[model samples]
Target: MNTSRILRTTNVVLLLMGYQRHWFEKTSHRFRLSLPSVVYIFVLGVVYTACFSQHFDKSSSTLKVLKDISPFLFGLIRVQLALGAKAFAYAIYSSVKSVGAINSLLKALPSRNSQFTQDEASAYLLLTSTFGILFCFAAYIAYEMKFELPPLPDAMLGMALLLPHFILAGSVRLYTVLSWLSRGQLKELKKNAEEELRANLTKDPGNIASAIFTVSTEGLENLKTKLEILEANFCIFAQSLKHSMLFLFAMHANCLLGGFYTLTYYWNTWYVLFEDRKRRIFYAANASIYAFIASDYICLMVVLFMMENERRNFIEAIDLLLAQRKLFSKKLRPIAKDLRGVLKKKCFKFGGPFQPNIIYVSLMVCLQIIIVTLIVTVHYLEDEISLLKEEFSSTDDN
Candidate 1:
């Protein structure tokens, strides 16, 4: 999949977006954080403040006035919140990198040339990067069309908005790529561990206690060391992403909530547009905005769910190995003890005790979609439902 090339591209893009430094830059060839990163963030802040400040003016359009009163308040809140979160995360990321944690973690990562085919990985990378970029652009176009801002201001706002959309979309793609690739690596490791265990057990089928002895102590210790390193690296990765992951979760939630409210509030206007074939473009664009939001949210939730599933499966394999600890000699018992310690720890941390199970997260996402759907459906059918009730009453009278 040309991992080095992809990594370089990602580093360049991230630095341009707004970061103190790139996360996975090569040791031999580093990309230094320069003045452009700060300038970009500064420009973004100025653009956001200038745009919103004008919108808040009493003489401005009704749309601007209404934005303050509506759920679009979240839209305003999100920009500021995102900027703050990004800054905080970048600070943390920079500190983590300064201490060499990032480099160590990068080194600990399994080879890209594992069991997952390069062609398949490349396809996924291409698909995700393309979809994220296109979706962001589509959302921007849809927003611009739906709002119908004046030319100069519209162009300026589009420039301001488009950068963040593209940058954040790229960030999301990067996260998903890492998650799935790590999942594949973990899966490969688990498979190898299982095969080794099976082979060891085969040599002593009648005596479970003798299996550990059948495998060379050196081989067992090597596997133990690998797991130890894996656990440490996984934790470092999670720690590095602690703030950023929370920010992403908040962003997805804010978008979904804002989108749902926006759709419901504007349904009547949109329905009118829908009824007019000539104005259907407006309706289609508005719908696409929400579609992009829902799709992004669901895409993230599904990938994380799959990653968690693989993590749990791997943990269970380790647990099975630990279960036969009494059979191991003193040398191997220490390995079992360390494995037990790893079991006690969380694989991924998402800011303190906020770790959510996949089922809970999936259900919450599903519920949001269903609720948004119902809101649109009920509003669309409101007149029909009223007529049906009137007809039933008249028939009863008759």
Candidate 2:
């Protein structure tokens, strides 16, 4: 494979796995931790010490104890979540790599017509640059969290986490463009076949039946070749897609837990921070980071929807070919039948069971709404409780 082309056409799912591995190795080089890793460890150690070192009274209320220890809990949960996501990504990478000859088959497909138009290229560039800027903003927030100068290491870690998202977005854009080109080629081939029939009729009027049969045979051959290549590509994609779904699920779970902790346990602190002029920038930065992460997840889901749509298009194209019952040769009929059978048997599924579609997207949106509703409810209840306590104390004084 041409290294540059591979990078350009790289699957985002695989790229994420590679980034995880890269991050791990770079941070733990020679058993010496990177600055970010060191800071993370130190902060975690301090939290642990505070929890166990009798800094708070042993008889404190359960809620008070939990409030003090929530940071530690959040950190532990996030680390485990990161590990789970990495493991899932690795599994997906292995599955994709094990598909023999698929890589070369992908490369063998004609590339002449696959070049992106200017508008398509600009759109992709804009999307990528937008994500890149969002990630940089995230890195800035992460660094500000520690009040550190020369925040290069923290910023790099933030970029590392987002690297997969950037690559995935670019890959999806490229795939869409390539699919468009393929469809255009099929249309052009059909037009050419019509012109060929007209020419043959003018040149040899008596052998019309033979000329038609020959033209039909050639057209079937071309269509069959293209379908075969596409089928192989989809097979590889479907397998990797299954693994990607797993990773996405794991990440979603992590995000849910982290978001819950932030809103439930740290909301007061966040509100106070936002009220301070000097700290308001940090608050906004952190909020933006979370927003971007949420958006990235939604974007990945959208890409999967697009991929599934493309799969349907391939099946429809094959169906259209088969529909011309009188035109296809006996050999061509069997080829089309076999292709349809393969597609029927292999489907892209989530967690090896649920097939995702528009309905899945709807459910995800509803879930987010429910989570936000719960957060708002909690905040309201807390406010009411504090108000009641103040009223009771005022009554006693009177």
Candidate 3:
């Protein structure tokens, strides 16, 4: 037991050191905040969490309300509330449009058409650069709360797990650019099939073979028939999954990080309430919660940046493919299919049996970044919020 305990302690120390390295090194040094400040915030958050829980325990009415909502239900509600209707609508639009547009681009495009459709000239790759800057207000909050929490190990854990998701999504976006290859190949194959039919029709002089070849060639050898083969297949959707998967990773990471922070905060609050630390604990809990909310906002802004990059990269690829594109030498456009708001497809069936790839890892990484950003932001910003609010009010008055 003693040996096991020593090993655990050593492992934690090493992990903590590694995390600190990333925080200082990987995070742009220009944005680096003070470590001492962060520690102070964590300590405060811990004390507050403890007090809040103690108060809640004493308040039978509040305890009853909390008990009425299960963890899973509460989590779902929180997610829905946080995202809002606009966010959900945006998600639906993006998912449907991107999928359908890619499908159309693939169907009309021959193999090797990825080069043409790729919109390399797009100024929008940094689509949210301006918008993202606006969200930096969250950082102001993070900076203030830096002294109220514990080790922030949970945030670190979340980030470590989710970083892979971002990379995976980015990789997939890169692959989508290669659609030109698919378009080109599709075109070449159809042309060959047509040529073969024509050749056989002319050469089979024997009445029996000639008649047979002519009948078969009449319908099958036509441009429309051959072009139909290039329609977007489920296989294509499965193949184009790099970015969406990365997105999923980002979601998972945020959820985990949020959950961990909430749980820890609640646990501490409960402990404090049990210890009869009422008002002080409530103040602490509120501070941590406010900081956490700010941090989450910041992390989401980062995700917006990643997603923007993916979209820009995708458009450029499509435009590249579009340039050399020749999908239906005999044109036949597919009508738009009905779309839905919900992700109603059964997970196993929709995703298909393809083994998971680096996309999964990429998504996980994005998740980790989001979680860590929130934990740190919330931990750092709690203290400054009071003065910040006053400044905001003053600005408003002026």
Instruction: Give the per-residue lDDT of model 3 (tens digit) for 1-398.
Output: 12122222322332232211112222221112346534743553354344333322444444355446334334543453333222323332333334443434334433221232323222122222222432453344344455355334433322332222222222233222323223333434434543433333333234533344334434333443434433334235444553454444444445555555545555544444444444444444445434433333333333334433432343343333334323211111110001011111222112444423235434545667666667645753663586699999999999
Tens digits of lDDT, candidate 2, 154-187: 3333343343333333333333333333333334
Give the local distance difference test score of model 3. Answer: 0.36
TM-score of 2: 0.55
Candidates 1 and 2 compared: the better one by TM-score is 1
2 against 3, candidate with superior lDDT? 2
Q: Which candidate is the best by TM-score?
A: 1
Quantify all predictions' global Cα lDDT against the true fold. 0.54, 0.45, 0.36
Best by lDDT: 1
How would you encode candidate 1's per-residue C-alpha lDDT over 281-370 as one tens digit per residue? Answer: 444555655665555556566667776777678768766765664443434556545654553567642224445446656776777677
Better of 1 and 2 by lDDT: 1
Please report, as a residue range, the 10-residue window in candidate 2 with the lowest summed lDDT.
21-30
Candidate 1 positional error at 119, Å: 8.0
**Candidate 1: residue pairs that collide:** none
What is the TM-score of each predicted model, taking all chains together? Answer: 0.65, 0.55, 0.25
Predicted candidate 1: what Cα RMSD to the true structure?
7.1
